[model samples]
Target: MSIWWSLHLRRDAASVPLARRFLLGAMETAGVDPEISFDLSVALSEACANAVEHGGDRRVQREQSVGRDPWDVWDEPAGTACGQYRVTAYLDGEKCRIEVADSGPGFPARRMLRTSAQQHDPQLYPSLSAEDGRGLCLIEQLADHVHFGNRPGRGALVSFDKVLKWRKGALLMVS
Candidate 1:
């Protein structure tokens, strides 16, 4: 069976763990290996954190473009705010896919170039002392496949997927 869920989370720090917890619960229920789940959760947190920190800029830009007060979005309902991000997960027969999308300026062209190079050799682009610039690398290392890009006029998108390794007697085991 294929199971999937999507969340529209506020651009707040708390949403990071909330997304992770939901992912963990889904993985546990599907009988995914704990180690794999942990890896994915960490990667998810990094992506969510980036969104929480940067996603607001795009909302402000969009609001300005449409002649609305940038702060007006804040008055909307919790999840309905323009300053929000999306997290989606899919657990299929043999793999799980996770995506985090946000309303931000998106990655710069140079960053994508660096990301491609890092994917080939992450060691070549280590940020030992820096606070940021490690999230995409971490996600690349944890996931079997990762795609980073933008959604046209929307914003940044980070999509990653891993081949599911089942625990003993997994509910959705493909055996």
Candidate 2:
């Protein structure tokens, strides 16, 4: 069986947990192993937090300057003027994929370089003391596959997937 869900959420702190909870509930209901579910949930939280905290304001300003309605471009509900982020998840067999996209300035090129450097030479790069920068690292460690990109003229996209392992006997019940 395959399951998928998408959430269009306001760029607010509260929305982060909402997204995480939805994912956790979905995984629990589907009998996804707790360990796999926990890892995905934490990664999802990081992604959502990045979107809410960093994705919206600059994009909104750019859209307004061009006389285009920002929310309209994203197809957000009418009357919702705030910036929005989207989270999507797909589960098929033992693989689960999740994407978090934001309408902010895309991931900085330098940060990507830094991440690469840190991965290759942790002693040289060390950990960033800045409030930001840890989320991508956490996501990289937790997900089996990770991809980063931009959304055309708009925002940043972070996608990650994990190959799940079922609890003993759970696979039989699912089949």
Candidate 3:
């Protein structure tokens, strides 16, 4: 699989929708069906929103866009926050890939979930203390994979994937 683009942006409300359309269109342009576009949109939107809220401040958010370096230049720019969030949108033959990263202080995926959360919750609960926890949880439920891991000195990556499934459902797609 080849990653076409990895976008890095600040933690701002203004950029949320722009980030959504970027992933949605990338999926279609890579041959993902329009029927599931909404799913991808919702998942990616929430991931990016989490990055913005927990990742860093305005100076860090607005200045950190466009990069190819995975580690070297990643944290040098935002020393205050110590880690940056990244959204990698790419495609393979059968699946569209999206990853939202926030390399801040965090535990690995195994530790983050408890026996209580391991159980299913249809409503996808969000915490009252913070407005953003639900988005990642929802992404996990909706996307094929949602990964969370610490990125060395940075933070974590919430990787999202939606594999293209053929026609048990294409009766639902129009174009």
Question: lDDT values of the candidates?
Answer: 0.80, 0.78, 0.63
Look at candidate 1 and give me any clashing residue pairs: none
Ranking by lDDT: 1, 2, 3
Per-residue C-alpha lDDT of model 2 across residues 1-175, encoded as one tens digit per residue:
7889999898899999999999988888877899999999999999999988878656234434366554454643222233788899998887999999877777766555234445656653436676667787788889988888876557788999999877766631346
TM-score of each: 0.82, 0.80, 0.68
Residue 136 CA displacement from its true place in model 1, Å: 1.0
**Which scores greater on TM-score, model 2 or model 3?**
2
lDDT of 1 by residue, 1-175 (tens): 8899999888889999999999999999989999999999999998899889876573343334355454444333222244788899999999999998876777777565335545677465656888777877888889888888976556778999999899999988787
Cα RMSDs of all predictions?
5.0, 4.5, 6.2
Among all windows of 10 consecutive residues in model 3, the one with the lowest summed lDDT is 166-175
| Best model number under TM-score | 1
lDDT value, candidate 3, whole model: 0.63
User: After TM-score superposition, what is the CA distance of residue 91 in candidate 3 from its true location, in Å?
Assistant: 0.9
Candidate 1 at residue 101, lDDT?
81
Residue range 15-109, candidate 3, lDDT tens digits: 77888888776665555576667888898888777777666532444355455354444555443343345677766556767877664554445
Rank candidates by TM-score, best first: 1, 2, 3
Give the Cα error of residue 27 in candidate 2, in Å. 0.4
